[model samples]
Target: MPTYAIGDIQGCELELQRLLERLKFDPAADRLWFTGDLVNRGPGSLGVLRLVHSLDACAIVVLGNHDLHLLALAAGNERHARKSTLDEVLSAPDRDELLHWLRHRPLLHHDAAKGYTLIHAGLAPQWTLGVAQTLARELEETLRGAHWQDFLLAMYGDQPERWRPDLTGIERLRFITNALTRLRYCTTDGALALKEKRPLASAPKGLVPWFQCPGRKSRDARIIFGHWSALGYWDQDNVWGIDSGCLWGGNLTAVRVRKSKPIEPVHLPCEGYLTPGESGD
Candidate 1:
């Protein structure tokens, strides 16, 4: 059985089909670990969300920032639609079911037997893989709990600028969302600079990409993430970035966990996105 860990699909559903065909993926034999943001940017947000929801047994997904935003917008946390990419998802006939599935997705997934951990973005500098997973569990449970709407309400900001386990309510949820999904740069003091999605040297005066930060807690674990399309295909010993910006006229990317260093990536042409908005990579 071949398990393929794919980067952010972000509403590019047909590419997923083509890539799977290239790999000869059998739903019964192969499993898929998605790094999240399965619906957004691209044109098939509704279809992708609906399909992933049905692939419950064969697919595992972590919640990406866009995914969280979709939940918040769906639950009426955001008054107006944030962007054009999400309008389709919000207005879909089965919006409720799609939002339910998205909100209930996990924050992180780790396969010990396979030696790879999957997150929508990358990990924080101060957290070990174990600690990251622990925090992820808290957020996942909170999202899945009855008061999930309350969490969604507080899930949109980046005010605190740090992490504290004692944080309750929406502040905690927001932090988790950023750290696990929207994260890109970090401060020298280990603060999250979620707004900047740019790469290392071009980042602000005092920021480094979280995965490259020295003394990073989750640095030891092999991470597979799909958020930074600009980061492209960084291949360090422990981190594998798979976002090739398929929605932005780039090719879809997928990496086999066990075969991280292998032949050319199976590329699929982009179906293009609905709009040319700011990329979440």
Candidate 2:
């Protein structure tokens, strides 16, 4: 089957439709691997959610930071509710269904057959592919279980910036969540530099994009990720980043992923909804 890994939609439904059309996507035969951030910042998060959810088995999505923010707001986090463009989703007639669907989404996806791992952001420098899978499942099952709301409430911190095998409870989960869905730059020793959202050339002292750290354990694995719009559709070494800043009037991108073929991005330009410096979700 033909599979397309798409960049962060960020609620750009019109552009998403256009991009799919450009790819000549057939839901019946082709599969879509969405790079998360399906809602927020754009003009049509509600529309985008309904469309993607309706696709059912044709699409697979890993949760993004913005997606988690929507869940936090739905779970009564007033802080996120204030500046969010997620009002449409929160007030939709099908709101519960949508949020329920979103919460159950994975933090990471790995296809052993294709030798590709899909995450909303980059992996930790210390995690091997096997450890990454185990940690992803720990969080995945928590999100899908009865203690989910409790987990959501505890999932927001940036503490324990570096992963330690000795870390336990929510602290461990939080670190894993940040690494998988929110990471960008990290220090050489793998400390999370979550606040450094600048472009690569402007990287703060001692920090490098997660994928560039020397001797990283997952360096040999093929990774497809989103969430660093500043990096913008990067393809380097074994990593491919497809988030092209659609909300900032950049392109909505998609790349064909196959075991044998070369990967190339197909983009649809967006009539940006948020100006630079605005909150994305």
Candidate 3:
């Protein structure tokens, strides 16, 4: 059974279909690992969500920032961002089902056999494969509860510029969500810098990519993630970034995780949105 790890869909539904066709994906014989951002920023958010939700095949999906934003907005905590492209989903008849399914999705997934860990963004430098899974559970439990909106409301911001084990209550939970979904560069001390989504070379002085932190303790494990569209389809054998930015007219990409050195991608071109004279369908 082959496993394909796909990048951020960002609501590019037609693009997703093209990608699967290119890969010759067989639902009955293969597995799909989605790096999340499955909705928003394209013309087909509702369609993409519906398709993935009904796959019935084995799939591992972690929550991306766009996915989380939809959850918070659905819960009436925040308005959709001006830059958001989620109107189709917001108006969908099955929006409730989609939102709930997303909330309960895992924050990180690990496969011992393949030595692959998948998250929306990437792991913190300090977390072991063990500690990352533990904290993911801590946040996941609250997300599955009534207090979820409260946690989402508190999930923004980049204060404290450092991580501390003593961080309690919503603060700690919020930190985990941000790190797993929105994180890019971090202070030398492991504090997340969620606002900067630029490429690695352009980061502010003293800040380091979360995966490249000094004395990186967890870099030993292979990780696959999608975020930071700036990073594009970069593959480092052990670290795979599949976020090729379909919403920005880049290709949709996926990688077979169990492969050996120099990972290669199964990629697809972006599909056009409905033009003024054409129907979206």
Candidate 4:
């Protein structure tokens, strides 16, 4: 029962299929974990959604910023859909069902038995595993509640850049959302630099990759995340980043997670869909 944690698909259904074939995946015995961004910015958003949604029993997904944007668009937030490639999904006959499933997907998943935690992006430097899980559930409940659309409408923003226990209302939720889905770099003090998406070598002064922040509370736990394709495949500092920029013609990557053995990563080259620098999450 091998579990594979895959990088951001970004709507690359064909690449996903090829990679699964390469892994010799047996859905009944193998579990697939996606770091999210399962849709948007590629040619096959609809197909990708259908395929993953069909494998609900064995597939685990955390929501990426792009995934949230897709939900927002479906909830009538059209202004942000200018560059979106989700029309096919929106118009599909099963659109509601797919979105419903997506809406219920988690923001974070932790398997204590496997000793691994999964998230779409970075966590606040101040969060321990328990804190991260609690915050995740807070937003998860809101997304699953009756007013989820209202939450979506108010979800866009970068304010309240730092996390605080006393934070309340939308401010608290937005911070939680950004930290879990949009975070990459931040000051050691935990102030998110969400606009800085470049690789580590080019990171601006005073900013460090969230996982690398000194004395990070979650540093002792193994975390798997994506949403930083610019950082490529990272495997250091108690974290693994597998988003290899598949949407930008880079390889789609996956790593086999084992309880006691070294993890192994596999990659499949992707045909260029959108060139680098056109846009990013």
Q: Clash totals for all models, in order?
A: 0, 0, 0, 0
Q: What ordering of candidates by lDDT runs from best to worst?
A: 4, 2, 3, 1
**After TM-score superposition, what is the CA distance of residue 102 in candidate 1 from its true location, in Å?**
2.0
Minimum summed lDDT over a 10-residue window in model 4 is located at 74-83
In candidate 3, residue 15 scores what lDDT? 90
**TM-score of structure candidate 3:** 0.91
Tell me the lDDT of model 3 at 97.
86
Residue pairs with backbone atoms closer than 3 Å in model 2 (clashes): none
* lDDT string, candidate 4, 9-121, tens digits: 98999999999999999999999999999999989989999999999789999999999999999888776788899989999999999999999999999988889999999
TM-score to true structure, per model: 0.91, 0.97, 0.91, 0.98
lDDT of 2: 0.89
Error of 1 at 23 (Å): 1.5
CA RMSD per model (angstroms): 2.3, 1.1, 4.2, 0.8
Question: lDDT at 277 for candidate 3?
Answer: 21
Best by lDDT: 4
What is the full ranking by TM-score, best candidate first? 4, 2, 3, 1
- Quality of model 4 by C-alpha lDDT: 0.93
Q: Summing lDDT over every window of 10 consecutive residues in candidate 1, give the lowest-scoring window.
A: 272-281
| Residue 148's lDDT in candidate 2 | 82
